[model samples]
Target: MSTTTSTTTRSPDAIRGRRLGVLLVLCGAIFLEGIDVAMLNVALPSVRADLGLETGVLQWVMSAYVLGYGGFMLLGGRAADLFGRRRMFVGWLTVFLVFSGLGGLATEGWQLIAARFVTGVAAAFMTPAGLSIITTGFEEGPQRDKALLVYSGTAAGGFSIGLVAGGLLASAGWRWVFFAPVGLAALILLGALALVPKEPARPGRSGQKLDLAGGLLVTSAVILLVLGVERAAHAGAAWTAATVGAGLLLLAVFAAVERRAAEPLVRLGILRSGPLVRSGGAGLLFSGGFFGFQFLVVLYLQELRGWSTLETSFAMLVIGIDAVLSPTVVPKLVARFGNGRLIFGGLLVAALAYGLFLPLGADWSYLVMLPGLILLGLAFALVYGPLTIVATEGVAESEQGLAGGLLYTGFQFGAALGLSSVTAVAAAYADPLEGYRAALLVPFAAVLAAAALSLPGLRRRAEQPDAEALPGAGAGAGTEGGTPAGAAAGLEPARG
Candidate 1:
């Protein structure tokens, strides 16, 4: 009989080197998925000209992809838990690359749009599944934190590269951009196979039944919502109202299905936690506001200022820099102000940033945008790590995956609706500055709402003892069996 001896003397350098290797793979995969998100947008105009497409057909290219990504996000998170993460990772990567190549070869808008939809479906699996890879590979705490920072860093960096590439490739012809990601995808796929650890068989793996009805309803709802917002400028009040009602009805049904499903896509109780609830709402609001600022200014830069695509791309780098820089700054802010203060303060700053943009017009200089960009970037920094911490902080270790998915999903949906909201307000008013001014108000309102939601933590419920004892409280998240102690505390036992 042999007894295995546990060794605690392994060198720290060796352990770190291995982690570094794993982090690169995680970052690389995540970067590809993210760049893909905005990469095609950069090339859209070129794609339209090349395909000889009518203006109306161009909508399909972006819409198809967004529809696929949003529609499948909830389902993808659960799928990772069911199928082996490595298997899904490889599967999605293969499909994403294939579609990329197809889009490159396409001669017509229809072919490109179809390919984009396929790519989005492939990416839905790729992104969250890629995230699952980070979850299982890095043991939680510092190592995990470091790796996630790197992933965020990579995503931010990729967006920058996407801008540069979009500018260069649009000049060189857009196919180069498609080919670039394909080559990058091939490299990442090879590295993943060799480096990504094999995931264990899931405890109750029935290979994802995937609430089809729920998925379809949610997808339709989102599409209708986006379309309604886009058409607000064209559709009469009656038509828009009808679209809005139908979308809400669809979403309500989707929620009900999730509430009762044995393997619900979204665990509704997770939202019951005060912190998660606050984080979700604030995230939605904040992203909406952020995107609104971006959309309004982009138009100002191009339409009013007569900036070329390349010039605008370079100017936009300020926002990109701040987006990438925030994760690095968050930990220090958390140490100083605590999560709640940072969150509130961040929103306050963002509201101010938007206020600065309201006075601009056709005569605006590049210098005028700087102060707002700096303030906006600072606000962005305040949110990244603090919100991420709040989101997963109280999540049970087992539910960390769910928390991560839920947290980002809030941002994604918020981004979709929020950006749309800005467009609607702007279109409604017809005055550019007035519309942007109104859109900025959304973030300000969200900051107030988020603050109210968080105050409950400062109070004690009659029977509930201390705030720390709250189920799904911050302290309870991400503990035990590599799970967050909080979000998982009341979660139904691990789905088998």
Candidate 2:
């Protein structure tokens, strides 16, 4: 009898070069996506002027992108899982590049909107695919933690950098905002083709079909919900209420479909995971508050105070501090104080920052807002990175894409709600100062809610072992014997 020699094929984590390359490429792609969003907002007025668009039609340039991004995310995430992640990522990136160029070239309002919508759809697919790659590619330990922190930091930086880039570019021409992303995206695509590893096919996914029924219902629900929120801000109550009701009904239907489908777009059972659910809720509130606050601040600084776009961008740059802090500072903090305390503390700090803004006056000094802005930036550095870790930690490899998608869904919906609700509240008051003050309340309350939601997670942390004591807790250079981050966080190890 001969003994068989078995070969153990190590995961991509074994190679440092490939892992770093993949992370850098993903960060670049995510950064481009973030910049694309913020830059467009900065150029919106210019876009309207250049295209001779009506106020109503101009809104669509922004709304069309949101609708496509939020609506198609679930379908896109599931497609990454079922099809190949690399294939989906590269293909969608190509689409994004092409449409971004189209958007830059478009003379008509409708043509620009169409290009934006398609680009958003492409981002829906590309983002989750990139995130799933990170979740699966890196070994689940400090190494992975470091990568994620960098990822989160880059994303925040993109938004901040985008605003500055937009202001500078818009001065030259509004079209450059769209054209810039094309060049950045093309470079990333070439890098990805070389650097990103091709995800191996899961054993059972080859024969599986997409849950089209679930996709349609969910997409329709999201689109309707977003429309209703925006309509409530601008239109009659009756139509808004009807639209919202229809969206709720479709959401209920989608849940039912998911429960019955052989291969569901979203596995309903995963919603039962407390960490995932709570993290999603907290992220929602956090994002909503941040976006609402930003919108009001921009209006206050630029429109009311007559500050130039460049000045406004510089004022907001303090909020981008997270890009530096996350990769450098947060990992050490996470290893010591834990994610729960940091998230809760961050939320409260952010709330206090917004609270300071509640005392706004027509001739307030920039010095008065400076402290709050710095605090808010610190809060973001503390919160965004760890919240992401919690959201995707417990999930299996196969469903990591779905988990990432759900977290981002909360983010997108929260932003829409926050911006729309605050705008509506502000519109209700005749006095501009009073309207701004009233709008400030929305973010303050939102942060309070986020802080409260984080309390349960602290209890969840107590139930688990010490993060350092757990296997792979802070395994710096060596990979053996330590528990992965998820298991340390009280979640099971991922199954292939």
All-Cα superposition RMSD per candidate: 5.7, 6.3
Provide TM-scores for the models. Answer: 0.83, 0.90
After superposition, candidate 2 runs with Cα above 4 Å error: 1-15, 460-496
Instruction: Evaluate model 2: give its TM-score.
Output: 0.90
Best by lDDT: 2
For residues 78-188, write the lDDT of model 2, one tens digit per residue. Answer: 888778678889999999999999999998988999999999899989998888777766656565677888999999999999999999999999999999999999999
Candidate 1 C-alpha lDDT tens digits along 1-496:
1222232343211225444565577678778876775567667778888888776688768767766666566666666655556677788889999998898998888888899888987877777766655654554444445455556656666775676567777888888878888999999888877766664344544545666677677768866775665555556889988887898999899899887887666666666666766777788778777766776777777776777767776777676664465545655555555667777777778878777876666577889888888787677766655666666553444345556666666666676676667767777677766776676676656655655655543333312222332333334334444443212222111110
What is each predicted model's overall lDDT from 0 to 1?
A: 0.66, 0.83
Clash tally, candidates in order: 24, 4
Could you tell me the lDDT of residue 8 within candidate 1?
Answer: 37
lDDT for 200 in candidate 2 is: 41
Best by TM-score: 2
Off by over 4 Å in 1: 1-15, 202-209, 429-496
- Where does candidate 2 have its weakest 10-residue lDDT segment? 1-10
TM accuracy, model 1: 0.83
lDDT of 2: 0.83
